[model samples]
Target: MAELLSNSFPATPTGTRFWAVDKILLTYLAFTTILILGWWSRVEDAGMLFAAHVVGVALVVFEVKRPNRTTWIFRNWYALPFVASCYKEMALLIPAVRQTDADQWLADLDFRLWSVHPTVWLERVQTPALTEFLQIVYTLFVPAVLLIPLLIWRKRRPEEFQYYAFLIALGYLASYVGYLIVPARGPRFLLRNLQHVPLQGMWLFQIMQSTLDRLESAHYDCFPSGHTELTIIAWWASRAISKRLFRVYFTYTPLIIFATVYLRYHYTVDVMAGILLAAILIWSAPALYRKLSREA
Candidate 1:
C-alpha cells in the first residue's frame, strides 16, 4: 500500500470519473446533510445551511456527472470548500447529537496522565519568543497540509493525489466524528483559570490569536486534535511525495503537535489521541483506499 502511494506509481489522467476522494467528500456531506435535517430545529439558520448542503451535493453530483464541464481547478480543489462546510455543518450538528461538551472529562484524563495539567506545567518554559514561534508553527498546519497534495497534483500524479486526498478526508472526517463522540472545548477554554501564565507572543500575537479564535471559534472541536492528526498525516504522507517536502514536515510536524498543548488549544490526551489516530489512519487507510478505489 505504501509503495503503491509512492511516486513510483503515477495515475494517468483517466477520463473524468468520480474517484475515491470524491466519494469521501460526498459521503461526509451527505452524512452531515442527513444529520442537519434531523436536527435542523437546533441549529441557527439551519434551513439556510441545509440549502447550502443541497447546493454542495448538487455541485459534487454535477461535477461527477459532467466531467466535460470541469477541470482540475474545480475537480481537484472542490473538496476544500466542502471540507470547510463539513466543519461548519458538523459544528452545528454535533450539539444536537450530544448535549454536553466533554471538556471536564478530557481534562481529567490529562490530569491523570501527570497529576498536573500538561499545559500548566508547560507554562514554566513559555516565553514570548517561544510563544510567537509556536503560534506561527501552529498556524502553518493548514498550509503545510495543503503543500504535499499541491506538490503531488503539480507533479501530475492523479492516482497518488486521489489516494492522498482520500486519506486526508478520512483523517479529517474521523476527527469530526471524534468530536461528536467526545466533544471538548480544549485546554485553553476548559483550563483557562488553571493556566497562570499568559501566552504572550512577541509581535502580532494578539492579532493573530484573535483572528484564529474568530475563524475557529466553532463549538467543541478539541478531542483527538485535528491539527495534530492532520499535520502528522500530512508530514508522514509527504515522505512518499518529495524529499524536501518530507524533510520540512519532519521538523514542522512535531512542533505543531507541541504547540497544540503549549498554546493551550488541546489537552495532552488530545495530542496523544491525535498521534494515535494518525498512526491508525496511516496504517489502515491504504487498504481502505485501495478497496474503495477499485470499487469506485
Candidate 2:
C-alpha cells in the first residue's frame, strides 16, 4: 500500500531536488526575493525580512531531508500557513504599491450590473439572526480548506489529496498575486457611507468578530475574494470525495458567496472574480500538477 501510494505520488528524491510544494515555495521565494532586493534600501526591518527568507529556506531543507513526513505535513498543515505568511510578508514588504482604494470601480461595476451596491443594499435586510448565520457560514472557510484534504488523506487517497492540496495552494497563489496587483480594501473599510452594522450572534459569532478585528490588516486581500475561491475549491474537492459532503458544501456555498458581500468583506466584482479564478484553476490544476510533479 505504501509503495502503491509512493508510486502514485512520487516521493521527493534524495538530495536537492524539487517537489510540487518546493516549486510553489520557490516561486514565492523568488518573487519575494526580487521584491526585497529591488526595495532593499527602502525596506524597513531588514533583519526580519532576511529572517523570514532564512526560515523559508530552512523549511525547504527540512522537507527535502524528510520527504514522507514532510509530504504529510505539507498536505495536512503547512500549505495554508505558507500561503498566509508569504501573503502577509508581501503586503508588508511593498505597502505603498496601491495608494488609493479601488472601491469606486467595483462599486460602479456593481451598480452598472445590478443598479445597487450589493453591500449597501444587503444592509437593508440585515437582521441579527441572518448576520449570525452568515458569520457562522463565513467561519467555515478556514475549516473547509483544512478538513477536505484531511478527509482525502484519511481515505488513503494520496493522489486525490495531492491534487486537492495543489488546487488549494493554487487558489491562494492566484488570489495572492491578485492582491499584489490590485490592492483594494473592501466595502467595510473603504466605503464609509455604507451603513455598517456590527455582527451579532452567539459565541461563534463573537469569536469570528474578534478574530476579524484582530487580523484586519489583511484588508488588501479583497479583490478575487480568497474566501469565495477557497470555499469553491473545498466544495469541488468534496464533490470528488463523497456525495454527502458535496451536497452539504453545495448547499451552503450560496450563503458563503452572499456572505462575502453581505458581510461587507468583498464587492460583487470581487466575488465574481473569485468564482472565475476558481474555474480557471480547477480546469488547469490537474495538468499543472502533472507538469510540476515530473522528475527533473
RMSD of candidate 2 to the truth, in angstroms, is 4.1
Best by lDDT: 1
Give one digit per residue, the lDDT tens place, for model 1 in 48-97: 88888788778777766765434445666666666776776677777786
Steric overlap count per candidate = 0, 0
Q: Find the number of clashing residue pairs for candidate 1.
A: 0
lDDT of each: 0.81, 0.75
Candidate 1 vs. true structure, TM-score = 0.91
